[model samples]
Target: MASVHPRVPESGIMSRPRPRHLAPVALLIVSALTLVGCGSDDESSEPPVASATEAEQETPGPDDEPTEPEDDTSLADFLRSAKVDDALVNRLGEVGDANGYGLGEGVETSLEERQQLATVQVGTCRDVAVGHRTWEGIQASDVSSGGTEEQAAAMADFLREEFCPHVAPYKEAPLPKQSLGGPEEDAKGGRGLASPVSWWDTRYRRVSWSEECAAQTGQPIGDPVAYRLSDDAVVCATVPPAEQLKKHLISVDVVFAEPVGEERAQDAALSLLPIDAVAEDETEGTNPDWSYLEGGCLNLNIQSQDLEDVVAGLKENAEPWAHAVHYSDGATADGAVGPYTGEVKQVSLSTGRNEPTDSGDLTC
Candidate 1:
């Protein structure tokens, strides 16, 4: 019974990704919800503060750039308020009105909670011109516990009837495994969900250069939804059970392509971590994950839960060009020596004689 509110700093609140997969307790009300930095529900909360390419561009001369559009307060308000009705007609209307899109007549919206599903759809013409952006894309969840059969069936129905019909014509109904969020646990039979993780709290880039090559070459980048569906998405890896760590070092060997010096490697590893999680500093209440990168070899100690998950994600998302990566979390080994067979013979160097020993042969 709590609403997701942005956790802001004292100075101001900056838009960040919505924690759609947030655990219930994480949805508890914070101090106040502000419209100043809030973004639409579909938008990632972390709006990019600055762009590298933009910085490199020389300041636009007075004649080079047109007058920038003025801030639309009402439109901003609508984006900030981010509300949905039972039918979701208002939501659809608001989006269409804001973006000048159309929802064909006779669209039905029956299922209420199905809006949270993660999906990819063809965006506006502008989106296509730049790159195919995720239209009305929701955050995909990793914490879902697969809802009841009834809930699953209803979601399937919604996908077949509403989503596939109107949103994505080429997309098929998402299997239960693909459902982003899941059923609420009853006290009698369910375990409580874990605290929310802020992995998805990332800056959203409006324009994409992914399809730049295709656009330049006059080639199709294929269906946007299909492309996204087939794309190799790296998700958080499942942690092994405690028993799996019987006699293994909970470590990982990461080899960078070019040998980045220890200092640079350490810094790069540190940058991948969240602000709250500690690395070098061992202050009070500090949960640190150690990494020592030498000669392009990053020997990591994946002790903390956050660090373990992060390493798992790295393994999952590793590019083909990366040097090498090996995990030892759930690794096992055998102690017995090699099985060998050999004939036993005694050779006397002084006499230059070879004689068969009492031991006929040896086998191990």
Candidate 2:
């Protein structure tokens, strides 16, 4: 399932990758929820969606898994409640009642990462909130049912009524059918825009991002920053330090993807920041002891000395990158690794996240 809204195609964003295959988020794959319910109005449209994978695989078994809350009823009842105040204390205490199954890279605190956290039995309120909202709105419709234009019309309609008005404060405000972003690209790079600014992600404003260019440059951003969602797959940010440090460096970008999930993004970027903590911290005990991987940290720290060099190289240069190069062994073209035909949907170098759509129009 693609992550974009059923009506929109995924060719909104694109990223130019460097050689050596170091960038983590090579491909942005959003498994979109099936929004247009099946059958008819008689039956409840909501089918059981995959909350996440079963914990038996990635997580440690009974021997290594934690055993805190043996009783499952109390926990479920507590989470489903409108009032969790009294149970809050007990809830925090009972967090690890089950084993930490399938939490390999761990869960991400932001909405972007909730996609991976859904796999576990235990989760944070934020985790539950984000995942629930995303999957709950799954509207699955047959592509042929509403011709592409018809789908685009439906999408435009949805944005107009349910999604657009809230787009005012965004960098790219007015989302007309003619275009979703700014002006058209000119010979001398006149006016510009990529896609319509999205509000689906902003429904929950917990994410933190800057309004302008927040590169790692110590100087100032000379350009206006623009970002777009690949339907439901990206969250871009023009962050601060990135902007502050933009002078001496080339460029620094980050990407979060499946399997390893969102927490990895936080972990990856954390080491780059000046501070040791963030409002949304990494997963508890998420980093393993990979102390022996040459210069690689269990947390996957990029060389502190080389950060500026890498960023400088990225910003000052331009080269096409292919995400398929980073795939693990055994992944296939038709299977896990595929002949990736998705479109590059979003690019926010500030926060280093990119979302792609599978519309088959990508330059890659």
Candidate 3:
């Protein structure tokens, strides 16, 4: 679905990505055999979704001859080269059960198999013909249905768990220690971005992404940093690292469409900072009503190497960001990612918060 949430972080707090992608999470309160569902009632309009079930009856397979043009011309060569024989499908089951996720015998299959199985299994299901299309730069899953999202998530999770050590494309032997956090948070402690602030620090966090995400992002694929794809929508921070605070780098998630290259993406990322525009308010007493925005991470090590430029980019971008209204907080900002977009939103621009260090370095 086309997201009403801006593809990129709009300038301000109120303008962050909306959390529309997240499935409604209801807290099931179970007491003495009585189950009371407790959560925001706003999601009451959503349909009672069903999970993807194993194919009860397989439909006659598609013709060997091509029916329509390949769904994704980009994937033609890969599909042709990659074997999807009965052996591979069976392997999926073996891997699934071995991993203990209970994918069982038929739940695990390739994108092609999922489409074919859907034809007969779910009457209303539409085949996600082989193709590649990213939503806001994330790889969109080939399967899209009530339980498809859950299935895709589970598959990605188990595949990474079992195969990442040897098969993951992004795993490097001497992988750099990394931490996710904001500019303010130190590598030692304090909450800044998320974690893994260092490239090769021992305290870094281990990250993983799904094969669907790897295929869709079309980046340095087969890596842990690959942007995670979603069947329905996306959440920030949960996928790849957006803009890294270490060496400054941006991803399509932040800049929107094709960034062209590192230079262009860097420039665009810097634009979002709005440092110059907010100079007058940069003083200690300055307190512009600030909020947060978010972007996606490409997981690429490429960078501009100019840390100042990166901070400036954050400052510049936040100035004009379209702010979203916070019904609970009674606050607003330039823009936001979505309701479930997660953290890594906009960094604080308040004078004290964005103040420079003794060496004149940006704090966050």
- Candidate No. with top TM-score: 3
What are the per-residue Cα lDDT tens digits for candidate 3 across 112-228? 332222111111110111112112111112122122444555545533343222221232223234554335333332221222323212222332333323222222211123221
lDDT of 1 by residue, 40-139 (tens): 2235445566677786685677688676987534322322233322244344333322222222112332221112211111112123234322122111
TM-score of each: 0.22, 0.20, 0.22
Q: On residues 212-258, what C-alpha lDDT tens digit does candidate 2 reach at each position?
A: 21211111111112233222323332211122232121223332323
lDDT, candidate 1, residue 146? Answer: 25
lDDT of each: 0.22, 0.23, 0.25
Q: Which stretches of model 2 miss by more than 4 angstroms?
A: 1-86, 98-235, 238-339, 348-364
RMSD over all Cα atoms, model 2: 22.7
lDDT value, candidate 3, whole model: 0.25
